[model samples]
Target chain A: MHRRLALATAATLCGALALTACGSSGSGSDAAGPAAGPVKLTFWSWTPNMDKVAAIWNAAHPDIQVSVQKQASGDDLVTKTITAAKAGNAPDLLQAEYQALPTLVSNDVLADIAKQTAGTKDRFAAGVWQQVTLGSDAVYAVPEDTAPLALYYRQDLFQQYGLKVPTTWAEFADAARQLKQKDPAKALTTFSANDSGLFAGLAQQAGAKWWTSSGETWKVGIDDAAGKKVADFWGGLVKEGAIDNQPMYTPAWSKALNDGSQIAWVSAVWAPGVFTSSAPDTKGKWAIAPLPQWNAGESVTGSWGGSTTGVTTGAAKAGHADAAAQFATWLNTDPEAVAALVKEAGIYPAATAAQSGGALAAAPEFFANQPDFYTQAAAIAKNTAPAAWGPNVNVAYSTFKDAFGKAAQEKGDFSAALTAMQQATVADLKKNGFKTEG
Target chain B: MSTTLTDRRRTAPAPGTTPGDAVAPPRRTAWIPTLVLLLGAVYCLIPILWVVMASTKSSGELFTTFTFAPGSGLLDNLAELSHYRDGVYWQWMANSALYAGAGALLSAALSGVTGYALAKYRFRGRTAIFNILLAGVLMPPITLAVPQYLLMAQAGLADSYWSVLLPSIVSPYGIYLARIYAAAAIPDEVVEAARVDGAKEFRLFRSVALPMMVPGLVTVFLFQFVAIWNNFLLPYIMLGDDHKFPVTVGLYSLLQQGANAPALYTLVITGALLSVIPLILLFVGLQRFWRIDLLSGAVKS
Candidate 1:
């Protein structure tokens, strides 16, 4: 029995060591084998939309196979990429978010795809090109989609409440107030109290940039006059009960969106896809309108969120790096493919040439026959303020979100919250070694 | 002597026997304990229930209808999740099994040997070694994971399975439990008898003392199994290849996509449901060996 138990223990330990050895040896062998294939490109994307990309690639290029490793959201993608890079086994292609561009660039994990694609900017929208560009020259990402916020409302509810589609923010606020009075149980608009999404949208309309630069210094204008004005207006609207302050992932939020408890949603061009996907039962009840602006002839168009693709610095092969860049560019700028993504995946094309295709021209009747949806979004995209989004954007956003949560739930002072966030934001940026201008 | 040992194990007084009276108080809280257990079970099962129900629905039916209402897309969602990247989900599951199964086995064995030494022998640095091992338990995994990654990178082993399994095999809590179990269960007399019968120390430990430690080692195995199975950070930090991901990381990446493309929610839910199978099977199969008495003192009968 003693001999048997000792042998079992040794055997188990040896087995563990052997497994580790086998794993190491296998990875070593995989290193020498055709890293590309049989031409298998390891593509990591953090969206279900990646399914569409995979399908498109599979349908066309059987020989040049693209294997997509799905990751959830940009947050997950960022975490996974960092982990993979640390591990010395990063995927060749990474689907990165536009806001996270600075972090990826500063971390030096991304390859400069600009050198690979000479003069590829001509095919992409102006805003898309501007967003993908860092400091004045280096391009870190190839733009995949552009989303300009639009008002998605229930036309049936609008007619019931005697509300015409308000083209301006003031008129929209007025209409919202009347609707709130008409039914005390519901609000005219619903805004996530903690989210800077609406504020970002408003700032874009006012042509305010989040960050500005003068060759060497980076200045954050988040608490600037235009932003403050926009913040105060929204703060006033919240006090008036024109909107419902709700959390994003709550059951109540989902219910409100579906049952007409909330009548309108201000979202991006890609958001319609989410809506159809989220609440399919409310199919014919929705219509799309160009986002209501604070002023007529002014563009209130701003990016709520967008994603791009980049090659990791830890890529196994240099040739694979070129392939990744090629794939990213093709996915972003290919006219036929971009249209397919827009038409099928509902990703609004960031590529200028793709936006003119039949896919963008054909409006889904489910969205209340909004024929000029892409055109309006294009106009918004053109006027979007070119801000130098810093690496601290996510950290600042989370800090402000917490303060927003406190104010909304705990009924704390909004001004105090904003002031605290401003201070914390400056401290965070300074700590990260980013030269910040007060 | 055997009867005396059994008597010592029974702490509960017989029913109808009190200090001076003819009747005794009940040892267990009958209805109250049962009620509390039921409530605990319900609380643990709610999120699991939601995942199971949600996995059955199409993305369209996910948030549009009642949350708990079952839909008809379980097989469809599974099919899609399976076909995602030529069935990478199964690869993650296999990797998780490798990490948890092999990790737990090695962990239990190491704990047994180290624990037997600490319990049976009086050594110069035993207390210090035990204390150092215990201190490892208090250190947050995140604090270690970052440095571990950096260290692995230096060794050029960061992305491999060794990065995950090596760190897991050295579980401090497993060693601590093994020590306590060894001290209580393995008798010095039994070791002496085996030595007198001409067995060496290692043979004595294997033949006589090991059987006594079986119940405790089983507990260590289960504990490490669950720890490795549910581990997200170590694998999340150490591996970049989606093929090498554990189910937790796989499900997390799937959910991230669902955030932008809500249609993937079905896949995330279905994938989460699929990930829990091995763990459930492990717990059920080895449950008899999970003697709660080992936590207090190893049962010797």
Candidate 2:
């Protein structure tokens, strides 16, 4: 019965895909001229309180009114937006992650708004700006926020355990082993297999380019030297039982953080928000530091989560692209709007100007002990290594989760899991009819 | 009906053993079967029990305490859920009620008429039409959601309430069940007798066949109501505006606010707990209709 259901579902989905292809081809004729009333643009976002931020824009720009339609975030939203675009019913504006830009672009869902957003490029970091441009002249989106990797540790617990803050990978591993020796009941931290983005970020910090394209052909390097080094290091830790191998974002993980069974988290700038709810009892005891370096003196880090606002092709077809791009630029770069985004939505603004002062000068309430939290985060955000994303990032990420999840459970070889991820990603890319290179 | 009667009589207690069985202590209990059933019940109810217990805990105590231990944060969670975006959770609840209630009614009505025609009429192509519906019954509704969404977009009805409602109104399984029930419960001789008396076909169906099919149609209605109430993918894909979203999609949006914000687990659990109340009430209130025998005294066998 279950097999029959699965087959029927696959057939129906294929039928829908064929229908969407036919439907999209008939509706590309551009609608000319300005509207008789305000140019109403629909914006889809998953950020909390975005409606309030849009309201701030709405009160000022009566000419181009933007309405925010909140959506569930992550890879599913990327698919939803692409499907909506195929049906020619896509919203005018979209909040897409940095990695999703390539997929959206390849699908013809995003519009090139470089002409309108040209002047705002200086407002954001070069690395952050490059993500939206995709190393091309056409700008597909404006950077909204950036989540630079960092290390968060329990301050009092570190003092109690007589451990110093680690500055390099070697010291970090030694600390994990030392803590396990001191108290077998606790761990220095966990190596979570459930989060592929974390591993990808770690790889990026070690200068791995997972995806790179030249002309029309794509190259995938998921099992490159940097990626193998990072995976092997954590795999060794799990094998030795120096760190917990359980996944994060579970109830047990939350308990570990709350009760100090885990004293440190290798996370991003958004860790405080998570700690606020997941480990509310340990709020004031935590402090942030730069991610431990691959080399002893390196200052470079990598990003785990961030988003960009893009104008969709549907807006361009409806002749609302200019207004949409204007709003997108303002939403990211305008000081007032960025501050509202920071205050209302709790996002770490990607625009370099908004990273330090004004809305970010004060620490989050949950991190009240770290008075210069934003200042420290800004320093880490400066050296984020450039990340390469492809049109099939979703496939790569899912494969990473599955392969690494099993490997972590058995304390098995992670290099083998990485090879599996690499093969699956390459196979999917070829199946999608993309030209590929080794 | 006569075969069922004989089977019941054959299964009845033998005449000589009745008095002894009634006066004696109960036969040895089926320990293994009882244990298996108890285990099944526990397996089914533990998740619900977890939800109930987890809904009462504050975020701090939620994962730290014992799995089944109840905390003192239920009221706080309720207030927060109610205050979330000016009670948008209630809006979702109301939307779900509207979709499920109205969609089920319309579906039941359509199924009744279609099933009656299919069972009673001898028109050409009736067999083919029924066969097509059978194929549709085999096809899972989940698979058709994307195609239906594309069609709705073509009609300029995407993101509207009708997009969700219209697709839900044409359940093939409901129509199939209704047809089978009508064929079994309604006697052809009575319809012929009503027709011979010069009664119109519509009146004959309304006055005679419809009343007999009420019990079966009630079953159809309840099935459709629950299906539409719990449906997630259809409404999630159809509706863009959060105001039009059903509770399933609304709770999903709460849980997936992005990587920066933690999921609102307490409020979602509380909302889930509250949402099931209406379903329970509905099941309890409408269960009496299910007891009406489909063919009770409808024909002489």
Which candidate achieves the best DockQ against the true structure? 2
> What are the runs in model 1 whose C-alpha is more than 4 Å off?
A1-42, A49-67, A79-90, A315-323, A339-346, A364-382, A410-416, B1-42, B48-61, B64-88, B121-124, B298-301
Candidate 2: residue pairs that collide: none
Residues B120-172, candidate 1: write the lDDT tens digits.
Answer: 77645557666776787687766877767766665567767888998888777
Candidate 2 regions with alpha-carbon error over 4 angstroms: A1-34, B1-28, B291-301
lDDT of 2: 0.88
Model 1 TM-score on chain A: 0.86
Best by lDDT: 2
Docking class of 2: acceptable
* Cα lDDT listed for each candidate: 0.71, 0.88
- Clashes counted in candidate 2 amount to 0
| Worst 10 contiguous positions by lDDT, candidate 1 chain A | A21-30
